[model samples]
Target chain A: MKLPRLLTRPIAQPPPHPSAQLVGDLAARLEASARRRLGRGLALRHIGTGGCDGCALELIATRNLVHELESLGLRFVDSPRHADALLVSGPVTRNMREALEQARAAMPEPGFVVALGDCAVDGGVFKGSYAVEGGVEAVMPPDLRLPGCPPSPRQVLEGLLALVEAQA
Target chain B: MTPAEFLRQPPAQGPTHALTEPQWEALAADPELPLLALWGEPGVVRAAFQDGNALRLVALAAPEGQYPALSPARPAAALFERAVHDLWALEPVGTQDGRPWLDHGRWPVLNPLSGRPVRHGGAPPQPEFLPAEGHALHRLPLGPILPGIGEPAYLHLAVAGEAVVRMEARLGYAHKGVLALMPGKSPRAAARFPARLQAEATVAHSLAFALAAEKATGTEPPPRAVVLRAVMAEIERLSVHLHIWAQVLALAGPPALADQAALARETMLAASQIAFGHRLLMDRVLPGGVALDLEERGLSILRDALLLLAEDLPRLARATLRHAGLVEALTGLGVIPPALAQDYTAGGPVARASGVMVDARLGPDASPYDELELEIPLHPEGDAAARLRQRIAETAESRRLLAVMLDSLPDGPIITPLPQRGGEGVALVEGPHGPCMAWLALDDGGLIRAAMARDPAWALWPLAEAAAAGAGLEQLPLLLAGFGLTMSGMDL
Candidate 1:
C-alpha cells in the first residue's frame, strides 16, 4: 500500500508565450514615454462582462494571498482613472459595452489591456449566447491574454510579471 | 372538485401540472406550498412550488400574453416574473415594478426566448436607469466593474447625507441565458450550465440538477453514489465558507488574518484536487452519479484534510472573533430584522443568523444524511457578526459531517444508469449559502426541454436592501463582506 502525495506537484516550466513577446514590445515602447508621467508602478482596474466568475476568483487569490501583486509594484485601483492597465474577464456583453468603454476612456494613455480566462480570450462556453459579443477584442484590444477556464493563481502571476518585465 | 384533483400530474411525466389561472392563483398563494419559480415557454408558463415533503408543480396557459402575477402575494417571485417577461415576452399582468430585470434591450432580439426572429441589423435598445431623487440625495453606482475581484453587478445607492436612503441593485450583466441554453440539449450536456453558474458552489448545483433528473426519470442512484455526492457537496460547502470568511477578514482589515484565511482555503482546494481531479471540482458531479470514483489514496488524503480542517477552523474562528476592532465593526453592523429574512425566505447563514432554523439535510427526506445527527447553526443576532459566527459554525459542521460520511463509505457502483425515457424531477441540495435547487423538465428524447436552477442568492439578495437600510454608508462594505452574496448567481 502506498501513501499518496498530499501536496500538488510544482508547476512545470512554460513555453515562451507569443503574447508575452508582444506585450513586452508594447510595454517597452510605452515605458520610454510614460515613466515621467506616473509616480508609482503599474495599476490594474478589472472589468467583468459575462463569465463563469472563475478567473476573478483566482485573480483575487493571486493578489491577496500567494503572489501579493503589490510587492511586485502592481496595485489594484478602484478607479480606472488611476490605472495604467485594464484586466478584463468574461465575454463582452452588449449591456456592459458602455461601462467597459467608459472605464477604458478614463484610464491614462498606453491603455494596456490583459484579458484573463478562456472566456476573455475566446468567450469559452458563453460564446454563442445572444448576450455575449465575443472576447475582449469586441470592445478593447488585449495586449496579452491568459488562457484557461481560469488560469491558476500562479499563471495570473506569471502573466502580470511578464508584462512588467517587458517594460525593462 | 378539490384543487388537488384538478392539479393532476401532466401525462408527459415532466413535473408540470397544467392549471387554469384561477387554479394557479389559488395554489400559488396557498398558505402551504411556497412558490419557487414562475418561468415561461412558447405559449405556456410554469410555476414551481415546494409543498412540505413533495414538490407541487403547476403550469398556466397564456393565450393572449398576460397572466396573473405571483409577486403581488409572494415577494420572492418578483425577479422570476421579471425574468419571464424579459425573456419570454409574456407579461405578468399586474405585478408591481414592471421594470425589466434581465433584458437591457441591448440584444439583437427583443425577446430571445419568444422565438421572435432576430434581424441582421437593428438599433440596440437604450436602457434608462433613474435613481431616487431628493435634495442632497445622489446616486452612487457600484460596479458593472468593481475594484478588485468579482462578477459584474451594479448596486445603485441613493444616499442622503451619511445614510443610504434606497439601494436598487441592477444585475443580469452576467446573464448568458443559461436557462434558455439548456433546452434541446441532453441532460448530461446541460449539466455544465448550472455547474458554472456559481463557480464557488459547483458541486452543490451539479448535485441538485443530478438529483432532480433522477427524480424526474424515477431512477435512484446506488448508495455509494449518494454518499459520494454528499462528500463532494460537503467539500464544496467547506471551500465556499472559507472563501467567504477570507473576504470578510480582508474587509475587516489587519490584512494578516485575511491572508491566513486564504491559505486555509488554498489547502482545502489542494485537498479537493488530490481527491477529485479538479480544484473547484468543476464538471465532477453529473446527471447519473459522479464523474470519478475516489481511490484509496484519495480517500486517505480527504480524511486527513477534513481532520485538519476540524482542528484549524475553530481556532481561526476564535482568533478572528477575538481580534481587536473586529467585534466592534462586525457586531450590530448590517443588522437584518427577522421579518426581512422570513419574507424573502433567506436560507443559509443569512437566515440562520436571523434565527431561522431550516436545513435541507436535516429534514425527513432520505439521502446520505438520513442516519447522521447534524447541527444547524442558529444565531439570533442577524448582524454581520452573527453571519460570520454562523459561517464558522457551518464550516466546522461540514468538516465533521464530511468525516462521518467518509467513515460509512459504501462499496458498490458509483453510478446507476439513468432511464432511457425523459421525465421531470426537482432536487434540493444544501449549498454553503443555503438550499440551491434545480428543477428540470426533460423531453421524451431525454433532452432538457425547460430547466430552472435557483440559488440561495434569490432569497438573500433582497435582504441586502433591508441590511443596508438604516446603516451608514461607511458600514456597507462590512455588510457586503459578511453577507457574501454572489452576483453571478443572482445575474444567472
Candidate 2:
C-alpha cells in the first residue's frame, strides 16, 4: 500500500518542512547557539495587551511539529516566576498596563522582555488610540523587538533564538 | 416562529429605519426579532436584527443620552448595551447589569466615542465580579494573563472544593478601541481593524467588513473575487478547527495525535501564506475586493495542501477515537444546553453541537455559500466531544467545497472601485468560531462615520460561562479550548 507523502517523508529533513520553506539553516544554527550559550532552554511567559490575536497565533504555531521550539530549548511557562523572558504582544492598553508591569516585575533578575509583533514593537495600526498607551517600550523596556503586523512562526522562532543568544 | 414567518411584516430594503421611542421598546419586547447587535452614535442608538434572509436595523433617538434598555427583554442585549454605555455614554435605562463591559474605567477619557468626550481624572476603580453566595465556595481568579499563547481575560471561578459553582469572565483587557479608531479613516485604511479583530478568523472578519463596505458603496466584487473569498474563509475554518482539535487532544492526552493535527494546521497556514500572501489571511480581503488574485503557484500550493489534509484528517480522527481515555475525557464534558444556546443566539460549531442549527453560511442570502454545496453538521450531545466531531465534519465539508471551487474556478477582474458616497451597510459572515457581523456607515467622502464589528465570541462567551457550571476547576482550560472563543475578538 502506498503511504501519504507527509507520513512517508523522514522526520528530520534539514530545514524545509512541507509547504513554506521557512525554517532554514540560520534558524537551526541560532537554536543550537542559544542552547549552548544558555546551557539550558529559554522559558517564555506570554501576555496579550490590547492588539489582535495575530502574534499570539504565530507564537502557538512555533510549538507545532514544523517549528517545535520545545525541541530546540525554548518553551512557554504559565507563571511569570518560572519564566526567563516575558514575551508580550499587542499595543499596551491602559487596562492591561498595570497587569503587564506586574508580570514584568514578577520575573526574576536578569530576565528580559521580548516584544512580539508590530503592535508590541510600536502599537502598529492601533497607535494613538485613546485606549492604547503605545507599545511595550511605553510601559517597560524590551530587550528584543520582532516586527511584522504579526511575525510568522518561523520569524518568531528566529527572534527568540536571537534574543537568547544575545542575552546569554 | 420560523425566520420566514418572523419577517412576514417586511421592513424596507435599506439597512436602517428611524423609529419612535415606543416603536423601539415594542420591537425590543417582541420575541420574534433576535437582537443581532446594538451600538450608539451621537444622538441615535441602533440595533440590528437578522430579518429572514436580510439584516434589518432599527434606530431610536436618544437625544437625552438615555434610551429604554433592550436587555430588560432580550437578555442577549446585556453585553451590547453595556458596551454601548462604556464607549458612547448612552445609558441603557433600566438595564439589569449596568456595569461597564469593554471600558474598565482605564481609558484617559470617558465616552470616547461620544461627540463630546470627557477627560477622566483619578485612577480607575477596581472591577466588581458578580458575587457567588454559598457555603464553602471560595473565589478563584484565573487571568487577564492566561497560560500558553491565548489572549487575556479575567475569569473568576467560584469553587467549592474541585467543582466550579459559578464562573464569570471579566473581558476588555484586550480591547484596542477599534471602533473609536475607525471613524476618520477611509474604508481602505480602516479595513485592517476588522481583519485584526481575531487572528484565527481574519478572513471571515475581513470578508464581512468588505461586504459591508461594498454594500455601503454599492459595489460588487467580481465573480473570481467572491469565489476566492469563499475559498479563503473555508481554509481559515479548516485551519482553526484543526488547531482547536490539537489543543483538545493535547489536554485529553495522546500527544502524537495532537502533533499530527498541529502539523496539518501548519500546512494549512503555509498554504494560506503562499496563496493569499498572509498566513492568517489578514488584510487580504478589502472593501473593493481581494488584495491579490491567486496565480498558478498559489493554486498548486493550495491543491497540494488540500490533498495532504485529505489523507491526514480522517486518520487523525480515527486515531483520536481509538484512545478510550481521550474519548472519555472529552465526552460529556462542557455541555451547553440547546435552550441556552438558542437564548444567546450562539453560532458555528458551538450552536450546531447543541442542536441549535445556526450557521450564517447556510442562511438564505449567503451568496457564495448558496452556490456551493454546504453541510451544517449538527449533534445533540452538546459536549466537548460533540463540538470536536462538529469541527471534523465541517473540516471535511470545507475540503470538499475547496475541491469543487478549484475545479470550477472563475475568471474575471478581482475588484471594482467603490464610489465615494454616503451610505450604511451591514454584513454577516460565518467565521471559524461562529457568525461575525460588521456594521458601518460611510461619510460622503467615503471615510468611516461609525462602525461596529461584532464577533461571535460575544455570544459564545456567555455560553462558556454556562458550560463551566458544575465542572471541576481543572477542566476549565480543556472546556475553554473546546469552545475556542477569542478574547480579542469579543473584546473589540
Candidate 3:
C-alpha cells in the first residue's frame, strides 16, 4: 500500500534582486519611514460587501498570535474617517455601493487602500451576478491588491505595512 | 417506525411518517405552531415549519414542489412560501402575501412547455409609509437596501427619540435557490455545495455530509480519517472564532486586537497546510473518506502548532476582555437571553453562550463524538461579552482536542471508494459557529437526489430579532457584529 503525499509544499522562491545594495536601500527607506511615522500610528478599517469572508478571516488572523501585527503598531478603527488605511473585501454589491462610497469619502487624506482577496481584485466567480458591481476596483482604485481567494493573514499584514510605508 | 428506530436508520428513505406517542408529543409541544411536512415521493424529506407569532419560518431544502405551505398557519411562512413558489414554481396551497420571493417583479415569461407567456401582472401599489401612532412614536426606516459589509437586509425600527419601540428585519438578497441547485449530482459530489454554503464552517459542513453519507452507506472513514477530520474541523472553528472575536473587538473600537486576529489566521493557515495542503482546506474532504492523509512530519507540525497556540491564545483572549472600551460596549448589549436563543434554534458558540448544551458531537448516542470525551461550556448571561468569552474558551478547548487527536493518531488508507450506486445520507456536526447539518440522497445510479446544508444561523436569525430589540438606530453596527450571523451560509 502506498502513502499519499501529505506534506505541504514549500513557499516558492522570490524574484532575485541586486542582493546587498537592494536590501540596504529597502531597509534604510523602511526604517526612515517608520521613524517618521512612529507616534502617529496607522488606523486600519475593513469592510466586507459579500466575499466568502476569507479575507475578513485572514485580516482578523493577522492581528493574532501567528502574525502579531500589532508589534508594528497598526490598529483597526471603527469609522473610515478615523482610519489611515481602508481594507476592502467583497465584489462591491449594488446595495453596498453607497456605504462603500461613504466610507471612502470619510477617510482622512494621506490614506491608502488595500484590496484583499480575489473578490476585491476581480470579483472572481461572483462577477456576473446582476447585483454585483464587479470588484472593489470597479468602485475605486486600490493602491495595493493582495490577491488570494483570501490572502493569508501575514500577506494582509505585509500589504498593509507596505502601503503605510509607501504613503509615508 | 419508532423515533428511536428511525433515528438509527440511515437517512435514506423518505422520513418515516410513523412516530411514537412520546415522539409525537415532543413535536406537538414545540412552541412554534404549524410544522407542515411534504413527501412528494417515497424517500424525500421536504419539510416546512414555523412559529407564527415570531414572524419567522424555516423551509428545509428538498425536491422541487415537495415543500408545503405553512403560511396558512403562520404569517412568517408567507415570505418563505412565496420564495419557494417563485423559485420552483411549486404551488403553495394558500399564500397570504402574493409578492414574489425570488422574482424581481418582471414576471411574465414565455412558457416553453405551454408555448405561451405565463404572466402574473399586478398593479404597482402605492408605497404607504410607516404611520406614526402617537406622541414620541415615529418609525425609523433603515434599509432593505443599505450599504457596507452585509447581504441585502432591511431594518424597520419604530423609535421615539433614539429609543426603539419595535424592530423588524427583511432579508433575501443573497438567496440563490441552493435547494433547487442540489439535485442531480452524486451524494459525494453534492457534498461540495454545503461547505460553500457557509464558508466559515466549511469543515463542519464537510464533516456532517461525510458522516451522513457514512451512516447511509454503513461505513466510517478509517480511525485515522476520523481523527484527521476532527483536527481539521477544530482548526477551522478556531479560525472563524478568532475572526469573530477580532471583528467584535474592532467594532467596539480597539485597534490593538489585530495582533490576536493575525495569530488566529496563522493557526488556520498552518493547520490547513499541515492537514490538507490548502489554506482554506477545500476539496480535501470527500464522501466516504478524506482526500489526503497526515504524514509523520505533518503530524508533528500539527502537534507543535497546537501546543504553541494553546500557550499564546490566553493573552489574546485576555487583551480583548480587558480592553475598557470593548467591555463597556459589549457587556450588556445584544443579549440573546437563554430563552430566546433556544426559540431561535441557535447553535454553535452562539447557542452555547446562552447556556444551551446542544452539540451534535456531544450527543451520547452519536458516533465519533461519542467516542471522544467532549466538554461543552455554557453561560447563562447570553450577551455579546458572553459570546466572545465562549469563543475564547472554545478556542482553547479546540486546541487541546486537536493536540490530543494528533498525539493518538491512527494510520490507514486515506480515501474510501464510493460504491457504484452510492446511497443517501445525512450528518449533524457541531461547528464553531453552531450546529451545522448536512443531508444527502443518492439515486440508484449514484447520482444525487438532493443535498442540503443548514447552518446554525437558520435558527439564530430569530435571535437577531431579540438583539435588535431596544437597540437604537445608531447601534446597528454593534448589533450586527454581536449577532455575527453569516449571510453567505443562508444565501447558498
Which candidate number has the best lDDT? Answer: 2
Cα error, candidate 1, residue B450 (Å): 1.7
Compared with the real two-chain complex, what DockQ does model 1 have? 0.55
Q: Worst ten-residue run, lDDT, model 3 chain B?
A: B50-59
TM-score of chain B of each: 0.93, 0.97, 0.80
Q: Rank the candidates by lDDT, best first.
A: 2, 1, 3
Report, for every candidate in turn, its global Cα lDDT versus the true structure. 0.77, 0.84, 0.61
Winner by lDDT between candidate 2 and candidate 1: 2
Predicted candidate 1 versus true structure: per-residue lDDT over B1-492, tens digit per residue: 455445544435455677778887776565344565667776678776654334567778888768888787778888888888888888887788788888877777767877663543456555546557678887787887865677788888889999988877778888877777788987788888888788877888888888888887888788888888888888888888888898888888557777767877877777878998877888888888888998998899898877766666777888898986888888888888776776676677888899877677764334878777777779999899999999988888888889888888998888877776778787777788877778877788888887888888887778887678778888888888777677666666
lDDT of 2 by residue, B229-263 (tens): 99999899999999999999889868878888988
How far residue A118's Cα lies from its native spot in candidate 2, in Å, is 0.3
Interface RMSD of 3: 5.3
Per-residue C-alpha lDDT of model 3 across residues B1-492, encoded as one tens digit per residue: 533333344333442333333543443334344332222222222442322211111223333433334455444344445544544455554454656544443223311111122654564233233343546787766653343434445566777787666665544444433454456766666665565556777788778777767666667577777777877888888777776776676667566565446545566577677657877776567777787887877777777777667656786777777888878777787787776665555667887888876676764214555556777777778887788888888888777777677767777787776665656555567777776666666767767665656666655565776686677767767767656677666544
- Candidate 1 has an fnat equal to 0.65
TM-score of 1: 0.90
- Output the lDDT of residue B320, model 3: 78
Q: Score residue B91 of candidate 2 by CA lDDT.
A: 91
Model 3, residue B393: what's the lDDT? 87
